[model samples]
Each structure stands twice: as structure tokens, then as C-alpha cells.
Target chain A: MLKISKKADYALMALQHIAAVQFGDVTPGRVVNTKEIAEEYNIPLELLAKVLQTLAKNALIESHNGPKGGYLLARRAHQITIAQILESIEGPLGITDCSHEKDGEFCMQRENCHIRTPLLKVQDSIAQLLNNMTLQDMMGGTPLITIQSPTAQGVER
Target chain B: MLKISKKADYALMALQHIAAVQFGDVTPGRVVNTKEIAEEYNIPLELLAKVLQTLAKNALIESHNGPKGGYLLARRAHQITIAQILESIEGPLGITDCSHEKDGEFCMQRENCHIRTPLLKVQDSIAQLLNNMTLQDMMGGTPLITIQSPTAQGVER
Candidate 1:
């Protein structure tokens, strides 16, 4: 199973919530507080806060610290992809460390690992798909997948 | 990050180990014992046994009993896909339960869950990629990821 961590999920949901409110207006000052999002979405405050912090640290979103402080997107919705949001919160996205050439922590059997190269391709396939999907494409009722023959193509919204 | 469980990792490694030894011979009796696989791969015996048991139950592999007994693929290497192996070892492959209509445990805000549908599409994209890859493909030294531009097309080994 390919599982996205809860933190990554929350980061996406939170970003979508903010995007929905902004409605393509990329103004820097328009923001939503963590409490408002948590209450509206029923996400646990602590968990959502932590997820938001990572997003801010990755510069995907900006945070204000005043009494009326809140959060806003650092860039336009179309500029951020699902792959970027996921990697920001959860680290590099790949099947395993053996698939990563720069990763220092290779499995002990990696030198003799037969599955490494192929799994790296699987990883790239996944990364390409995710990288193609943006936050703007995720919002609204538009269908993301269009089945034109056996090959499923993604429609970028 | 999209994550495949350790059990699934071990399962793939073990299956690849068996497939490499078989060398495309679809004979039903070339067996590789769990002990040998665990020792060779440095995988924990208890964990590999559990994963193998799941594979056996799923009928992806046939297990033999007794002192000289071990296991062999239930079908040809080309017949078994990475999706099947992962699903057999690790339940259904998806990012979230909210995407599953029959899944009773929907998030508290499922009615307002804006990302569920798009996430489902993401899950399908991953599954389709995995389904295209077979156990036989993993056994060879062929480059799995052929970068045909930034699209990252999967090459059948």
C-alpha cells in the first residue's frame, strides 16, 4: 500500500481550505487562522498546527504572529503541486532509500539489491503523477481523471 | 511521502529472490525456503514468515510443508504484478479511507472533505503504475525508469 502520512494529508486539506476561500486571489495579506480551519474542518488543533508549521518552514505558506496572526499561501495555488506539499511535510517521496542515489542510508544488501533500479522507476512514475497535480486542480468538483483508453490521463484544472 | 510498508518491502525482495533463481522456468516446484531468504536478505525471520504467510493465503505463492518443504510462485512471474504483491502483503493500496465509499470510518468532516476525490485520483494513478510492473521485471538489470522527457514513462523490462 502507498500511504501518505496524516501530517501530509492535513497539510493538503488545510491548503485547499485556504485556496477555496481565496478563489484565485493571490493577495499576500489574505489569511486564515489555524483555529478557524481546525473548527471548520474538525481537524485536531495540535496536529493541524504542527502540519502548518512544517508548511511554513518549507516556505509553502507564510505565517503572521500578531494578535490577528494567521496563515496564507506563499505562492499561488497553481504554483504548488501535491508532490511539493507532500515532500515538504513528509520528506522526499520515494519507494525506498535504495531508490535514491544521494541517500546515504542504503540497505546493507543494496549493492546486490535487484529491485532497486526498477523500484526507482516506480518512484519516478509516482513522482511525475503527483508533480503534475496542483492545489488549484484539487479544489472544486471537476473530475481529475479522464479514462481515454486503458491509459488514465490526469486533467490539470 | 507515499510509503510502502516494511512487510511489503520484504515480500517484494523475497519474491524477487525466488524469481531470480527460477530464471523464467514456470515449473511449479523450484522452492526457496524462508530461512535462506531471511539469511540472504538479512530480513527478520519472524517478520518474513508472517509476510510469506500472507502471500500464501493470497495464493500468490504455494507453500510446502515438512523438513524439505519451502515455497514457490503460484503463477508465472509475469502474471504477478507489484500491485498484487503489495496488496497481498499489505491490505488495499490507497492514500485515505475517505476515498473508499464502503469504508465506514470516514473523517469527521467527510461531507466537507474537499480533497477526498482528488486524493482518490492520486491513489489510482499510483495503483495503475504499480499494476503495470510485474515480478519478472524486477529480476532484471534493465532501467525501470526511462526518462522520455519530464513525463517519466515506465519501461517494461
Candidate 2:
């Protein structure tokens, strides 16, 4: 199971709220504040604040300042991906410990391991599916990003 | 981080050893006991024993009883899949906690979640890739199974 961390979940929810508020046409220049989002979704303020900061630092969303200031999508919703958000919150998504490590680090199991290579293939497809899914696609918006086989892009399977 | 439990990794290693020893043609009808696999992979004997029992119970591998008693593949290598092994050890693979629960159970975030449906799409593709890949495919054997889109089979995307 590829466990999506709680913080990652919060981040996506927060972004969704911001995107809706900013782009819903109800409020053209409005920003979504953390308090409103946290209160609405019943997410913890401190945790949701930290998640928003991470997303801001990662450039997925931009922060605003003023009376009605908060956060807004830095780019179009379609430009952001679940992969980018998840990777920002968590680290890289590797199903196995050695799947992301090219040298296998100090893994003693590496030499005897025949499963690592195949598991890497599994991890790659996971990353691929994630990368192809945009925030717009996720919110029932237009699915502009299409799934492409990593192998088709000259990536070795 | 979709953490594959250490027990699941050990189970895969144990099965790989069994498949190689049993079907490598160097020795036919040989049974691979837990001790051999444990020592070869430097895995703990007690934990590996428990994992072997679970695999046996799942019928992914069969255990023999006698002077030559050990473990053998319950089916041919190509007949087994990583999805089967991982599920046998780690239950169903769901990216989100609520993705597998259609009714959302007692999850409070269900109503606020716009990501669940899209995450399900991601999870489905992950399952599709894992289901199509066999133990034999992992071992560099002829890939008799080809990848198929679940949606093409009339399963909803």
C-alpha cells in the first residue's frame, strides 16, 4: 500500500479549497485564508498552517498578505500534480527501501535481492500515474494531463 | 510513502528462493525449508517462520512434511503474482485509508474529500500493474501476461 501521509491529505484539501475560492468566479481576486479552510474541513489549524507553508515553499501555491489575504494557486490548477504535492509533503515515493537508492546504500539484502528491480518497475508506474494526474483533473475539472507510459518516454521499464 | 512491510519483503524473498530452487532444473522436487531461506537472506529465523506459515495458509506456496519436508510453489512461477503475495501478507493495497471502504465507514473526512475518487483511479492503475506482473516476470522470465486497462474490461475508470 502506498500510504498517503496525513499531512499530504491536508495539503491537497487545502489547495482544493484555495483553487475553488480563487477560481470559482464567485470571488475573482479573493484569497482563501487558513482559518476558513481549516474550520470548514475541520482540519487542525497548526497542522494545516504548516502544510500550507510547505506547499508555498514548494511553489505549488502562493501566499498573500493583507486584510482578506491568504493563499492562491501560483499556477493554473492543471499545472499542479498529486505527485508534486505528495513528494513535497513526504519524500520521494519508493515502495521499497532500495527502489529509490541506485547503489542500494548499505542494504545487505541487495546482493541476494532479485525483487528490487521489479519493484522499481512497480514504483515507476506509481510515479507515472501520479505525475499524469493534475489538480484540475482531480477536482472534476478538465483532465488535460494524459497518462503516458514512462517507457514510451525512453525510460527503461 | 507506501511502506511495504518488512514481512512482505521477506515473504517475496522466500518465494523467489523456492521458485528458483524448485524450478531451476538443477534440482526438481526439492523443498526449501524456512531455515535455508532465513540463513541465505540473513533474515530472522522466527519471523521468517511465521511469514512462511502465512504464505502456506494463503496457498501461494505449499508446505511438505517428512524427511525431505520443506516448501514448494503451490503453482507454477508464472501463475503467482506480486499482488497475490503482497495481499497475502499485507491485505489489500489502497493508497488512501478510505479508498477501499466504499461507504467511507466512520471516516469524517469523506464528505470533504474531493481527492478520493481520483485517488481511486491511481490505486486502480497500481493494482492493474501489479496484477499483470507475475513472479516469473519479476524473475526476468518470459512475460506471458500483458498489461490491460481495467476500464477497457468495463471496470469503471
Candidate 3:
């Protein structure tokens, strides 16, 4: 399991596109509309548009409406984390239905399944790792940032 | 899309069952049969049997046949990692089909998807976190262990 939705992926692709362009451009938050991103990344326009809508609604990105309109990061690139982007596009991040206790005791699996508690721990670890990563870490010209154990501070550059 | 397969879930359930029992008095490396695990967890017998076969084959656990035969941890409970158990049941973990470069170059998505590289990094972070955790870390009686950012030198325990 542990898969990211294509919608989230597209959202990331679109954001990375804007982040890369804005890294040094004159337009500090200038819109870079969906059409241009979809074409450059070969993403399906309709699908990417939906993803963009979710991000815009979440205020992760700003959407413009005019003919010259497009999308731009609502915040600085480093202010955006992959976890926030994923949550905006795909809701909560859980690898399993029973990852949270509120999933209830309706199923028989609940009777003997001790995995739920541990699975939740797994979910937490994953969410922590995702939350730690900023979009700036993955954008073009930046080396992919590595994960530091939640407690490890500034050890692995 | 981040979901663990039923087989992997069952595998974790079975391992946890064995680990729980082993945590108590009885015998070290005590074997717990498939029928018992399957019935207790309401897992499909045939499916869990296949999952156990893969785990046994991968040496995550040992299996025996005949009436008194069943399965036991291949090593100490503390030595078995969740990543090992999951990978044994599900093969290599790839969050996306294109997670690995060997996914082939046939799809157009592979040609232009900027997300793949960064996604692979995300996958690596998940895998590393899982790899760092031993089955004993999740077994009953042990308080849920918190993640120590991968380099903290074991502070959180």
C-alpha cells in the first residue's frame, strides 16, 4: 500500500513547476496557469485542473481567472510541505482504513487485529517524514532533501 | 492510494500474534499455526497461507508442516523489521509504478512526470523508517516507540 494519489502527484508537479520558475524570476507570486504546467509536464489537463482547484481552495496556491491568469504558490516555496500539498489534494494521509481509532469496532477484524495500533504508528512516521519535507527541498536545482529521524537534528546534510 | 495490501496486513497480524505469544513464557520461537492465525484474525485461510509461505520463503519466519507444525520467528522478535515482513509479503515497496527506473520507458507519463524522482525519495524515506523498526517495537507490552529522526543515536527509547 502506502501510495500517493495521482491527483496529489499532479498537484506536486504543478507546484514544482511554479516553484522552479519563481526561484529567481521577476514575478514573485506571478501566476503560471494550469495549461502551461499540464503541457510542460504532459499531465492530463482536466485532471491537473481538478488538482489545482483543490490546492487553490486549500490556499496552498493562488488561482487567477483572467485570460492572462494562472496559478502561483500562496506562500513561499519553503513554506509549503509535501504533507500539506498531499492533504490539500487527497484529504488525510492514511495507509489503512483502521489507521485511526475512530474507524470503529464494527468489523470482526477489530476483534483480533493488533496491527491497527502499530499501523497507526507507521502512519505517524510517514506523516512526520512528509511534513518535514518542504516543496523547496524537491524543486529543480535543489538536491533532493533527505529525511532526518524526527529526533535527529542537523546530522545528515 | 496509500494502502497496505490485505496480504501485507495479514502478514503483520500473523507476525504480531507470534510475537505476542513469544513475549510470554512457553517457548522461545514458538510456532503458531496458520489456521489459528487466520481464524483469529478472520483472514482468508488460503490467502494467509500464501502470505506465510512468502514470509517463510523470505526467512522472515520459519514454517513447519504436520499436525504440531506451524510458523515461528526466524530470528528474535527484536531482529525482525516491518520492512522485511512487508517486503516478504508484497515484494519491493514502490509507492508508484514508475517508482523504479526499471518500470520501463513505454508510458508517456514516464517520459515527462517530474514527480517520479521526488516520489522515489518519499518512498525511500518510508522504507527507511520501516526498516528501522523491529517487530518487537510494535509487539504488546512495549509502549508504542516514537521515531527518532534517523540520526539521533537512539534517544527516544
By DockQ, the best candidate is 1
Which 10 consecutive residues of model 1 chain B have the lowest summed lDDT? Answer: B146-155
Task: Tell me how much of the true interface, by contacts, candidate 2 captures.
Answer: 0.49
- Indicate the DockQ of the complex predicted as candidate 2: 0.34
Candidate 3 error regions (>4 Å)? A26-29, A103-107, A111-113, A141-157, B27-30, B103-118, B140-157
lDDT tens string, model 3, B1-157?
Answer: 4777888888888888887776667665567899988898788899989999999899888888998899888788778888888878777787776665553455456666656777777787777777777777665532225433454222222
In model 2, which residue pairs have backbone atoms overlapping below 3 Å? Answer: A2-B2, A3-B2
* Lowest lDDT block of 10, candidate 2 chain A: A148-157
Ranking by lDDT: 1, 2, 3
The window of 10 residues in a row where model 2 chain B has the poorest summed lDDT is: B148-157
lDDT of 2 by residue, A1-157 (tens): 5568889888888887788777777877587898998888878899999999999999998898778789889999888888899988997787887766675364667667767756766677777778877788767543433343322332211
lDDT of each: 0.77, 0.77, 0.74
**Residues A1-106, candidate 3, lDDT per residue (tens digit)?**
4666777778887888898776656656566888888888778999889998888899998877989898877899889998898888777776776655464444
Q: Give the per-residue Cα lDDT of candidate 2 at A67.
A: 86
**Tens digit of per-residue lDDT, candidate 1, span A1-157:** 6777778888888999888776655653466899998998888999999999989999998999988789888888989988899999888886875655665665766655667667766776677777777899887866454322122343232
Classified by CAPRI criteria, candidate 3 counts as acceptable
lDDT of 1 at B122: 70
- In model 1, what is the error at residue A7, expressed in angstroms? 1.7
lDDT of 1 by residue, B35-57 (tens): 99999888899989999999999
Q: For candidate 1, what is the interface RMSD? A: 4.1
